[model samples]
Target: MVVESSPTMVTRSAGSCEWTLVAEDAPVLFPDENLAPKLLLERFSHDELKSGSHRVVFKLQTGNGCYYFKHYKISDWKSRLQNWVRSSRARIEWDHTWKLIELGFDTCLPVAIGEKRKGPVVRDSYLITREIPDSVQLDQFVEKVLPALPERTRRQLRFELARQLGIVTAQLHLKGVQHRDYHAGNVLVSWDETSLKLKLWLIDLHQVSFGSKLKTKQCLRNLALLNSYFSNRGNASDRRRFFRSYWQTFQTKKNGRPRGFQEYKSTLLTIEEFCDQKMWKEFARADQKWERGNRRLVILEGESEQNACRGVSELDRDFLKAVSQNPQNTFGLPLLNKSVSVTKRVTLKGEQGILSGYLTVCDKHSKPKFSARTAWDIGHAFIRRRLSTPRPLLFVEAKEQQWLVTEAIPNSMPLTDYAQSSQAHHLNFQSRRLLTRQLAAQLAWRDRCGFQDNHPTLFNILIQPDSDTFFFLGLGYLEQLNTPVSEKKIIRTLAAWTSGSLPLSGITRTDRLRFLKRYLLEKEGDWKRYWNRIDSKVHSVHSN
Candidate 1:
């Protein structure tokens, strides 16, 4: 763990690219010719891990083993100048990783570092690290592998996993290093077949910070960052155990308690609040991206980015206008429970042969700007949020009339139609349970996006006839609340779902509660109270 000498740079004849060997151990293993960035670039493309704006990561297979190579590219003058005088991210990570290993923490071992410069500008750079063999991401292991184990084995594994992660996190804090992007995905857990214990290692160390012991706020932010990803994945009890184990280790390191009981409890609350606030911000940003006045979309529309007549291509604005002019021209079927809306399939001949789309002309309430344009924006919003809606192609405003053209979804049936079929009744109990659980989960997710549909029901959804996957069909009413959604909103949506789908779909009250339990990840005792309170509220509203 000692520095042999200063980092030596090798000038390669290929353009301005150069190789820097920081650790002396690298040259002894990887020959100078093979370590060239140009040679690495010429290697097969199949081992690529990821390509991003800042860097590209790939794995190189050799007789020895596999090595990870991350090449950083400076995209702008600002970044180029910044890295010219200073070490690149690859170098920083290379140095920090060695520091972590020297401190007796498990992390990826650095192999080599490379950079491509244009005169004084650092153009492209990369760092190489040896892969951690027989390891899987902590998140993937928890989601995919953990559930298949026996109950006793699973319980033991879960506890030990949490304890080890807690210990590592505490150790990092004690060493005054803050892993800014500390999430489950960044942590690797390797199992030893003989020892039956998991070894935890942290990866992606470029953002790792080193300083004096972290402040209270800094500690909370670090812990909150780690907890946020697991918020929905882990059950309340599992999360509580992890938090308790982490805090216990944290306090032990301080030789006593870090703060008074009340203060410490308040800190935990602060961490929860911080995590929730971050989640809300992400939701808000996503919600805003679909709004009518979104700057990017507006610019896109003005620029006529695609080959289309009348500032549109993929969708025919002229056809949409014709549909709006005379709705009766094409015979159409009416959507159930909705008299104002009508859908007719239309085909347009394009350069790519025949393209099928749906034209929906609906009557709108007499409100300012409440035209087809609004529905057009809302449809895009639904698609952006990954809701199951026909993708909107274009929105045409013809006088007071509204017309929306959308790409048609094939091989799908209305949720109501699917629910009443013999297929639904004949489905196995597990399939039925999975369908119900997914529906509840979607409702929960939509609620998180601040969508408060006044008449939420299975009738407003589309289901894949074979797979049973469902999509939200009624995007016209999905107005963005643009605020942090409350639990009450979710409860009300769940209530509507039960009232609308249960009677017709032959779903019993107990099965509905079971679905809710899975969505909420609630324990038996907690679920009972939650169901009672929500059920009472639903009944009171109906009776009134």
Candidate 2:
């Protein structure tokens, strides 16, 4: 493939910024009289499509068509020095766009690029490209569009997408081009519904490097980065098809035949390991964000120098303070439950109409900070794991008292109440079995993740009106184990669920057996051994 030169290249100055316009025909780019690179740069601040810490992307409309405008801001001195010595990121992306075009890969069409410099350092840069019509991000396509298609059509589309992605990636590596930020979001997909024909384009080329052969480790790292999104959204067979396509496409006559079965398996495992590490690091980063106040959360000072952490967009400070001071008397709301802690139903009028929540005030031990922080951290951990739990709204910690507020899950009831309610009798056998299996599967997943609740009882679990969905409550007793849950702990959990002290209603012996079967689906131990041990423990508990 030969690179084509633009017929016209022009440079213009707007304030301190110098804009470079490259086009096959400059007159066709800005058909409107008022549209220019200077005006477009001015409009970027107000017409944002997406904004990040260092980048702002917006869409510009001209008589010709719509184009994407991306502005990159240099924050650190290191980047400024690098840009001063070398090419700016916008220039790199502009150059890479032509390189990709020459390599016969579909990519965004570059329109114009600009950079602003101070002394010898580049402070800001911009890149503009013509928008790809009827295109969506690969992740959005898989999440939103695929599910809407028929089963057969959806399967076919998925296969084609996986195959094309593999081919494109292989071609890039074969051309000695490596994309550092290779992920689903950077790939754009467009398809015809009638013929099911798909076209893919690579975007965000600022992180790309050209003319460097990819090593084995680099290949695996790139594949793992792409696989991170699909690991959650795609199934095993989908991933297998992808790897098979990649292996077939990546092979060359000089490199011999395609990989062997052992090689493929080993590659898959390595990629999975890399993906897991990436995901864990992301989770840890999110935890750090919560600890040091992010956009969603804020840390504030409470009465008497106490500490209060609240959701920025969810609850107000006044409401949080009122609830923390005297939850039982605040707002004259009805008391929901009382034992060791006081629970009050709270309602507040907000921008989104009525916001309902539950405020629980508990007496703290000597280490109030540790206790309060533990509950807050555990609640966030459950949310991070995508478990169903009432969202934590606020946490206030004082010397002797701790207040926690949680958003109320609509149409939810405690599992204990639901089990004894008339709704339980109305559920058919299949629905009841599904509910049992769901509960068991949740417990199994939690145990597999090394999380254990000290008292795993039905009372602490909330069942939605749908019955199949369950939400965990009372996260204060939750503990994250360093090792896998032991057989003894498993038996204890089972005993807690079926003990005579709780006396759960409507659950039969068959339901318990079914739950055990589903829970042991991925376990290595003998099912009979676990069943027998759980049975023994339950029997002993009931007898006592």
Candidate 3:
């Protein structure tokens, strides 16, 4: 997917340094005459690299076997790499992590540091690190071996992997390292189909943080993300097994929260005495259900103290237990006793950098009366463009906190680099028209969906896999709904793209959903209408 730039994002890096746009889709060719560290590998070597994600990993095969060399981008947003000798907490976290790295942790350890670009000790610091060999990222492993693994191995691996991840993450929190992006991809594992080994390797370490006291809330949210990943792969029973270890390992640990909630009394946040006041939101006359947006749920043990679902009653448990015992269904998810789906105790991700599976729409638990229903409706329409343009409908379902989870699109490289960009760069004749048509299709969609009604200031388009595609995201701000004049601004943007054809302004959520219900579901505004579509999309995706 080739994403278009926002007027703001055209020349930027997440680390907040200026980026040099490639005039052509060729590899970067850093000069041979340049210094050894900067010119360690040819600029062309970067064609294999995805921009602004992993540390610069250069595979230079010297006469002595194969080795992967890494250098941190000097321009990272944190801008702390300029001084390695002057230790900040991030560096301390890095240093402390190295000190505490136990054996069997097959992570990329820092081999050395390239302290300067050409000058000494002032800027352009790089960490030279090794690669995790004979191992694959969990996502890659799933793509490659998941289908091939036997049912038993997959089942067992799910629970065991969750247990391992819980233990690892809990241990990290205990050590007071709050890894901002502690999702599945950051944690690497090596499995032989007999026994699996787990290793927690921090990736994209620019956002990683260190503090004397860990924020239990933040850590739990991070852990919830882990739960989402494993749950998607395994089943409910597997997730429960994972939580058993998590509660056992981390719950009783001392000094986990540095300044108690009492310390934050002055802040907007307040520790609540009542459970419902702190936890679940009552909406539509009830709390919400786990949506298809986040495909899986994480069961955090010892979470009873957190004012979430403690455990279901013995009768509910026995019924669920019997369902798991049934040979037809492996995971012991609560059954729909009636026609309606049962409300599930699930957790989702929120932070922007990492993939928070089916992001939960955020709100203030302290609000007098909260309803994410409007947020969900707005988000679903908005996130649609993202899922459509970058790829086809990869929509995540809506859940607690108004989360929308979708299955990942398969086999995509960043559109700016690699073969996709190569195919797109310097297009001759026929290709240009085709791409124009595709963009036209997207514009038609936005036009059909009516971008003008959106709150422009709150507008965000989250592009995926580094492409020109920008899917409109973030719709919590509702005041942007148009009057007669502002609606024209959006219409003009759509009109210009489509050569003056007027797309429906999509005046209301009801209207947008009417289109969605008809186009996707072949009906209007019903949950089953959508679920049937998803079941069809992932028909082959059954539990082992």
TM-score of each: 0.70, 0.70, 0.40
Per-prediction backbone clash count: 2, 0, 22
Query: For residue 232, what is the lDDT in candidate 2?
Result: 45
Q: What is the lDDT of residue 268 in candidate 2?
A: 68
lDDT of each: 0.65, 0.71, 0.39
lDDT against true structure, model 2 = 0.71
Distance from true location, Cα of 231 in model 2, Å? 3.8
Candidate 2 accuracy as TM-score: 0.70
Q: Positional deviation of 300 in candidate 2, in angstroms?
A: 4.9
Residue 208 in model 1: lDDT: 86
lDDT (Cα, tens digit) per residue for candidate 1, span 417-497: 777888877877666776786666666556555666754555778888565567776566556676535666666767776
- Model 1 TM-score (2 dp): 0.70
Whole-model lDDT, candidate 3? Answer: 0.39
